[model samples]
Target: MPWVFLVIAGLLEVVWASLMKESHGFTRFWPSLGTLVFMAGSFGLLAVAMRTLPLGTAYTIWTGIGAVGAFLVGILWLGEPAGALRLLAALLIVSGLVLMKLTSGH
Candidate 1:
């Protein structure tokens, strides 16, 4: 339901972020178009999720997922640094998301 939409939205956030990097400040046509499409889809799904989930909880989880996903993409795909501290920060963001999920009654 809403959670499904929320997850999809978060994933789309990652995709759009990657596309944004690929877009080269929107000079590249195809990646720029893809970025716009996914950005819209992500926002739409986030709005859908907000109908049922608490606003802060849903937003935090969505951004958390996007941040972690984008960071991994940066390291693995784009050759960004995979330092211990960076990895640890990513893990902590994920842990926070899990803790929020577990504690929230919604």
Candidate 2:
């Protein structure tokens, strides 16, 4: 299903973003390669999903997943502070994505 592909693409967005950070501006070798691979895969799948899904809804969900995922990784693994407000903001992102999906009428 297109939704399945979209969700996978969204998760790949997260992986690619995290790998991009690990890539050290593409200075590192392995992480850089991984970033490229995941980035391609993410976009490819997103395009597939876009064949049926509304463009704005699909794009918002993709970036929302990437943003929330990267933020959580920063807090949990990268030593960024996990403050209450930060957590709330992440929740807000998810909430917005859900509303968008619901109202997209796809």
Candidate 3:
């Protein structure tokens, strides 16, 4: 389904983003190559999902998913801050995405 593809693409966005950070401006060979491949795949899948899903709704979900995923990864793996405010913001992003999906007449 298009939604499945979109979710996968959103997850891939998270993967590529994490890999990109590890790539060290392309100085790290393996992570850089992985980043390039995953980035292209992520966008390709997003484009495919867009064929059936409304662009605005899909994009909002995609971005929301990416933001939350990245923040979680930063907190868990990268030693980034995990304060109450950060968690609240992440929750808000997820809530907004849910609201969009619930309200959209898909």
Candidate 4:
């Protein structure tokens, strides 16, 4: 399903983002290569999902998932700040994504 591909793409966003950090400005060979591969795959999946899913809704969900997932990864793995404001912002993005999904009826 398109939604499935979108979810996979979103997860790949998280993967690529984490790998990017490890890439160190593309100086690290392995992580940089991994990041490139994942980024391409993520976009490929997004393109596939767009075939069936509404562009606006699918893009919103994909971006929302990626943003929240990346933020959590930063906080948990990289010791980035996870303050109340950040948590609330992440929750709002999730809420918006859920609302979009609910309204889309798919």
Candidate 5:
């Protein structure tokens, strides 16, 4: 299903984002390669899902997942701050994503 593809794409987006950070501005060889591979995968799935999903909805959800996922990953694994305001912002992004999915009509 397109939704399934989209969700997978979003998750891959998260992986790519984390890998990008690990790449150290593409200085690290392995992480840089991994970033490119995952980025391609995420984009491929996104294009497939876009065949049916609305542009705005698909894009927003995809980026929302990436943003929130990367945020959590940073906090959990990269020693990034998990400040209250940052957590609230992530929560708001999630809320918006839920609303977008519900009203997508596809």
Candidate 6:
């Protein structure tokens, strides 16, 4: 289903983003290649999902998932700060994502 593809795409975005950080401005080899591979996969799935899902809803949800996912990844695995403000921002993003999905016809 389109939703399935979209969710996978969003997850792939997370993977690629993490890998991209590991890539260190493309100075690395394996991580840089992994970033490209996952980036392609994410884009491909986004295109597939877009065939049915509305552009605004799908794109917003996709970015929202990626942003929130990256936030968690950064805080948990990357030793980034998880202050109350940052946590609140992530929660707000999630809330918006839920609202967007609920309002979507698909």
lDDT of 3 at 37: 93
| TM-score computed on alpha carbons, candidate 5 | 0.97
Which residue pairs collide, candidate 6? none
Candidate 4 residue-wise lDDT, 18-86, digit = tens: 999999999999999999999999999999999888899889988888899999999999999999999
Among all windows of 10 consecutive residues in model 6, the one with the lowest summed lDDT is 97-106
Among residues 3 or more apart in sequence or in different chains, the pairs in candidate 1 whose N, CA or C atoms overlap within 3 Å are none
Selected candidate, larger lDDT, 2 vs 5: 5
Q: Which candidate would rank higher by TM-score, 2 or 6?
A: 6
TM-score of each candidate? 0.98, 0.96, 0.96, 0.95, 0.97, 0.98
Q: How far is candidate 6 from the true structure (C-alpha RMSD, Å)?
A: 0.5
The residue-by-residue lDDT of candidate 6 on 13-97, one tens digit each, is 9999999999999999999999999999999999999999999999998998899999999999999999999999999999999
- How far in Å is the alpha carbon of 83 misplaced in model 1? 0.6
Tell me the spans in candidate 3 whose CA falls farther than 4 Å from its real position.
none
Where does candidate 4 have its weakest 10-residue lDDT segment? 57-66
Model 2 residue pairs with clashes:
none
Off by over 4 Å in 2: none
Q: Which model is ahead, 2 or 5, in terms of TM-score?
A: 5
For residues 38-57, what per-residue lDDT tens digits would candidate 3 score against the true structure?
88988998999889888899
- Evaluate all candidate structures by whole-model CA lDDT and list the values in order: 0.95, 0.93, 0.90, 0.93, 0.95, 0.96
Q: Tell me, by lDDT, which candidate is best.
A: 6
Q: Model 5 over residues 1-106: C-alpha lDDT tens digits?
A: 9999999999999999999998999999999999999999999999999999999999999999999999999999999999999999999999999999999998
lDDT winner, 1 or 2: 1
